[model samples]
Structures are given as structure tokens and as C-alpha cells.
Target: MKTMRFTPPGYGGRRRDPEQVKRDGWREQGILAVSVDDERLTWPERELVRQLGDRLYGPRAADDGGRHG
Candidate 1:
């Protein structure tokens, strides 16, 4: 959606697809991924959060930064 601009939805009765993805070519049978406002925050934002966590907590002694709050 960011690469190209789109017209307002339902302006001319053109609507979005019900299923975001098709399982035709995909090998995985059951996988659902939902993206919200995808244009915001790239990988750097996630990395920055990781770096800040390390800096504030000193590399997380034994934890591998896996647990989610």
C-alpha cells in the first residue's frame, strides 16, 4: 500500500479481498498472519527496543530475550 497510492475504498464499489492471502501455491496449510498499519515502524524500531533493553538491563544475564510481556 505504501509503494503505490490507492483510491478510497468503496468509492466506486471496488472493495478489498476477503482473504488477504491465498493458500494455492503456499506449502504451509494453516498459518494466519495479520498486519495492522504496516507502513509504520520498520525493523529498526524493533532493534532499537532490543538495544534499549540490553542497555538498561545489561545483556540479560541468563535470559535470551525470548519471553514476551
Candidate 2:
């Protein structure tokens, strides 16, 4: 006689990356892409996206055309 053993699904599998998980969730919801200038995002969210963009890529032109007071 042979013994059969089964392990639970995803019990010993590699952990999924958090970023990938977020991307997957977005894909599932039909969110193909998001822009920093998207009006759907709140002011704070847009600011965060702008900061991330600066860190990942480089500084971008100010929306006010460099006018600061």
C-alpha cells in the first residue's frame, strides 16, 4: 500500500511581491494605467504620485511653469 499526502494550496509557494500584487489587482479591475494628472486622484494622491515620479525618473516641470510664490 502507498500513502498519499497533499499540501494546502499556496502553503509552500513563494510569496508574491507587493507591487506585483497591486498591479494584478489593478489589472483585474480594468485599470490599465494611471496618470499623475488624473483628476480622479485626490490632491494628496496626486502629490504622492508626483513625488514617486520624481524619485523613479527625474524632476518634472512644475504645473505652474516654475512660478512659485
- Please give each candidate's TM-score: 0.27, 0.44
Candidate 2: regions farther than 4 A off: 1-32, 63-69
The Cα local distance difference test for each model comes to: 0.51, 0.76
lDDT of 1 by residue, 1-69 (tens): 355356566566644464535342233666433222234547776556556667866665445658755
Per-residue C-alpha lDDT of model 2 across residues 1-69, encoded as one tens digit per residue? 976476688677688887577688787986444578889889999999888888877877665468775
Which model scores highest in lDDT? 2
RMSD of 2: 10.8
> Which pairs of residues have clashing backbones in candidate 2?
none
RMSD of each: 15.0, 10.8
Task: Give the runs in model 1 whose Cα sits over 4 Å from its true position.
Answer: 1-41, 61-69
In model 1, what are the clashing residue pairs, if there are any? Answer: none
Candidate whose TM-score is highest = 2
